[model samples]
Target: MTSTVVEQLIVPIRRSVTRVFNYSRNVKGLKTHLEELSDAKTRVLHSVDEARNRSEDIEDDVGKWLASVNVITEEATRVFGDEDKANKRCFMGLFPNVTTRYKVSTKIESIAEEAVKISVRGKFDRVSYRPSRRGIEDRSHKHYEAFESRGPVLDEILEALKDDDVDLVGVYGMPGVGKTTLVKKVAGQVKAGKIFDVVVLAVVSQTPNLRKIQGEIADGPGLKLDAETDSGRADFLYERLKREPKVLVILDDIWERLELDDVGIPSGSDHRGCKILMTSRDRNVLSRGMVTKKVFWLQVLPENEAWNLFKKMAGDVVKYPDLQLVAVEVAKRCAGLPILIVTVARALKDGDLSEWKDALERLKRFDKDEMDSQVYSALELSYDSLKGEEIRSAFLLCQQYRVVER
Candidate 1:
């Protein structure tokens, strides 16, 4: 009975030793598999941004698994070493403690099983990427309506987009002159026309947020990025963008030149199908640093176009016979700037002929700086329409500093 009990106790130990060997072999094989996967070369997965992203994720997972396995391997080695010392002592007539031997074997078994599970989880058979045939959908297209006067400017931009040699196109104009609207229209047209595989539009205001910009660009191609640092994000963006067949990046309202490298945007010359369309109020921002090919200036609407836009916004209020002449004068005072015309017309949309006349007189009081006068007076009228003193005060405070570069 004593011998039988001893044999029974040793059975678990023997089984555990076998499991440890199997675990080691399986882990070694898994490490080899992971190394092969990490080293395998594949075609540029441009069309499917997800595939590239998935590939990176797999690599990261493998790296983490390898690290974990290293720990498990060390534990297994220590457990086996203890078993060897116990056996050697038994051979030297120092009868090894059966309980300690059983514990060491159990520990090795547990660790080996965990390593096997990790190996199984890290297995990847093959990778396939499908290219996207459809262009990116533009959701903000509805917010921007193409102005009649921006037709020529739109044409110029379209021509620039078509030019193979022109990788960077810059559009500049005075604030409230429709720079954002023109670019939005162009982006919509490009997406609808399938000019590029992916079109990303990001607004970089006076205060540029690099992460926000990268997030916007990543959203275009459904790229899931886990980069914590700016440079890491840029590198990830660069790798993903480099694989795309054609990409159009529209950066709107850039106050100053943004470094393309810093943003992870490869130079136009480096990538054939990559193009950048940036809009700014300052021509110097584009010419001096941003634009690479040609800079297109967007001018204010002509008199007829300005009047048409004003009438459209003013609606029936400006249609009254008594207000016709006064409305024309008010529209003319807008000086072809769409923002001023729209603001004044919308503000007076519910006003009577007397209100229209009063607005015209108010506008006439500020004819000192011509264009500046019209813009300020029109904006001032809009400010006056505010319901509260606090709101008016806030508007005045904002007007003290020009946040929007003109």
Candidate 2:
């Protein structure tokens, strides 16, 4: 009986001693596993960097996995720290500190298992995805009413755009002649036809903001400009534009000569894939100032189309026999300007026969010698038709800021 009891005690004591001996080895093994985890983290971080360069959004699971790796790494650092201190607690630095070593080794084993599991989970087929581009849905062809007159002009512009040799195309017309609307319509068509891989649009207006223009262009391609200066942003924008295989940059409402380089456009010989389409009131701004390769003059609608547009805006009252003659004369007074036609048509649409005659007389009375007198007179009539001073002031405010889209 005594021999059997001693044998059992010996067996238990030997197993305990063997486990104590493995504490240091277990800590070392933790180091190797943590290194594997670090390698995995590095690979994932590299992928994240690449995805960011492409302007792609990181995957949710991938992002979470990265966070988890960071936490595990920090925990491993603390474990290694504990292991160092635990080694110091040994007798004369030559024996293991059994209690602390056991505690640290057990914790290390648990954490190391977690790290391995997370590393394996980090193997993803894709780390990021292409986000939906904005401007297309919000701005393309909003409130565009196609007319027979606009069709040919749009076709001509599209044709010029498709030509590999034509890099700069210009569309010039008087104000309220639908330059903005025409270009927007072109934007819609170009996108649908795939004439260009992408279309970026920015309005230059009478006073141009180079920074705003650059920002608008960058927004189209999902490029984030971190540069603080205009020139720096220009450099970034120029590089970005160069990468597009085919891109159309629509610089609408350019009042004067705009420096393409300042706006970061890679026009002419700099980039063959890039094409610029601009609009302005004066043909000279486009021809002489911009040195456009091809210039298209957008004339006011022909008389027939003008009358059709007026009738559409003014409603069926324009077609009534009693009002038809006076309406035709009133439509003629608009001089075929689309903005004038729409304005006068709506103002008189709900009025009586007497009101129609009064509008016709007032439109006829504006000084013909003044530039855009006819347009001004039509706008005045529309202005007078408003019911309140507040609404009229708002109208003038829009006019002052040039925010009123033609």
Candidate 3:
């Protein structure tokens, strides 16, 4: 009986141990599974973060693309529109329809408002882009003076030319104030292309050289003179220049009447029909040329314009975080001479505040009696290099006059 009892106790203990071992194995398996699931979730979170970063990158690329498209569109619009249209918002003025347009009316196509398309055949009166508003409204006069000027000066010249033999229309201004610029722009407007069929641009300077004048006239359309020789070149220029009907001749800078007929410049038409545009500094020179017509004088740039021009010429070196007052004071010293503005700008382009201050002090102490000593002479050296005699004299005369001739 005792042996049987011991056997039962042994059986119960072995079964209990087996059950405990099975339960422990199951618990370990469950813990391992939980750890694996946690690892998988961490990987998913990392992938989600990567996707968000890629999306942001894509958005930035798209924004850049949009900006590029906008720039291209603006450029395209500007290119397609007509620039010569009278109604276009040019900072300067327009030339009146003088003889006939040298080219097809480019400005006509650019008209945004209710405007008319004009040509030589279809009009009783000349075409013009008359101002809707008056007196320098939204116009940048200084910038126009520097690069190009097509304005009221041209309009009067063209009006004078309509008589068919008007000989001279002088556009006189100071050297840096844009007299030559205006005359050149006017020549572009009045010369013949499709409508008028003739355009003549004769650029001369202070002392007229017969050969240069002859060559200039001969180089235009419908004529090519052998300007290599003095006499033959003159004859060729004179004969052809006389033949063109309804012509606009620019004797750009005439210190004197220059005896246009004497130099191979043809003079067949009565003084009523032919038109000449001359620019010079001396009011007496211009008055002698245009005795009957009223004259227009170009002025110095306003204060703001002079400073802006100075800054542009100065370039990246003149930038100072704290020297704006110094800049304004220096700009004031320039008064309104575009040439001086450019000179100062080039001088100070690589300047600091110290350099700016130094320049201002120098100009302040400049000899008021001798403009030539301070500014005009420096500018005149640049003018002296011009091949055109008219340009040189005109530049000198401009230096002589501080105010415009009425």
Candidate 4:
């Protein structure tokens, strides 16, 4: 029985001593494991760079594994500092330092195992995924009215776009005449038909914000503008835009002359594949200021088409004979402008006979003035008809900050 107990204890004590004696081998093994981990890390970093170039986000597990590898490698580096002490002789330089060797060897083996585990975990099926596209989706799904009067102008714009020699196209109309709507329709169609590989829009407004305009256009191509100055940003954008083989840029509500190069847009002359579609309230803004190759004027809806749109927005209430005549009179008061027709029709859609007559009276009072006066008057009547003060306040704010012409 005594010999049996001694044998069992001898096995564990001998195993422990064996690990201390194998210190050199464990250190060498640690070095090999660290080298393998380093190679794996390099491959992962390369994949991360490629994924970023493609505008993709890295996976959480991959990021975590990379972080663990960094930690393990750092720990392994510190382990080497104890090598001399672990190899020192003790007892007057006659014997190995068993205690130090045991501690150092155990640490090396533990770190080596950790490094191996991390390297195996680094293998992944996918490193990243494409992020959601911005700005383009919002413009793609915007609401547009297919007015008959605007069809000819839309077709003309499309035809001009198809012409190889005509690179710059402009659409000009009075405020509230659906200039923005028509141009947006063109953008949607071109995007759907793949007329251009890249389509971007910037609202130039009455007061142009060059940086904001640059950002909007850059967002389309997933470009990050990190330049500190306007000129620097422009130069960067210019190079990026030039890389696109086929591109369309829509500058909306341009009030005066804007320098294309200053805005970082490659002119049609500079990049033959680049095309520009712009809109403004003044014809000269397009013809003289922008020097467009072709310009189309968007007219107000005709009287018959105006009536039909009014009927649709006002709903079944217009079908009643009693209200039909009054509705026709109200629709005519809109002067064939799409915005005014829709706004005024919605304001009085569910009103009684007296309310319709009151709106008609208000509209007539402003009729003695020019067409612009009539538009503002119809807008005023719509404002008064709104139920809540908060809604009216929001409308005023929108009008004050309206970026597009209408």
Worst ten in a row by lDDT for model 1:
39-48
lDDT of 2 at 279: 95
Q: Candidate 2 residues 342-384, lDDT tens each? A: 7667767887888888877877776888766655555455466
User: Between which residue pairs do clashes occur in model 4?
Assistant: none
Rank the models by TM-score, top first.
4, 2, 1, 3
lDDT, candidate 4, residue 148?
A: 66
- The prediction achieving the highest lDDT against the true structure is 4
TM-score of each: 0.62, 0.67, 0.50, 0.69
**Candidate 1: where are CA atoms >4 Å away?**
1-138, 143-148, 368-371, 386-406
Model 3 residue 214 CA deviation (Å) reads: 0.8
For residue 92, model 4's alpha carbon misses the true position, in angstroms, by: 35
Give per-residue CA lDDT, model 3, range 1-406, as digits (tens): 9999999999977654443334324334433433443343344345445545433222343334334334433543453342233123323545332222211122212221111111111221212222222112122232444332335556666576564445556666666666765666555545422323455566677667887776666555535464567777766666665566655566766666577665666543432334565677766777865452546677767777777787787765546657777877776676677766766566566567776776676556646576533343333333533334544555565455433322
Residue pairs of candidate 1 with colliding backbone atoms: none
Model 4: residues >4 Å from true position, as ranges? Answer: 1-142, 368-373, 382-385, 388-406
Q: Sum up the clashes in candidate 2.
A: 0
With candidate 3 superimposed using the best TM-score fit, by how many Å does residue 253's alpha carbon deviate from the native?
Answer: 2.6
Q: After superposition, how far is residue 15 of candidate 2 from its true place, in Å?
A: 19
- Per-residue lDDT tens digits of candidate 4, residues 1-406? 9999999999988977987989999999999988999999999999999999877999999899999999998898898999999999999999899999988988998998888889889999889977756435355536576766678888999889888898899998877677877777787788778888888889999889999999999987778899999999999999999999888899999999999999999976799989999999889989999999899988878889999999998899888888888899889877677776777677677788888888777667654565355555554554666655543653464353234333
Where is model 2 poorest over a 10-residue stretch in terms of lDDT? 397-406
Among all windows of ten consecutive residues in candidate 3, which has the lowest summed lDDT?
112-121
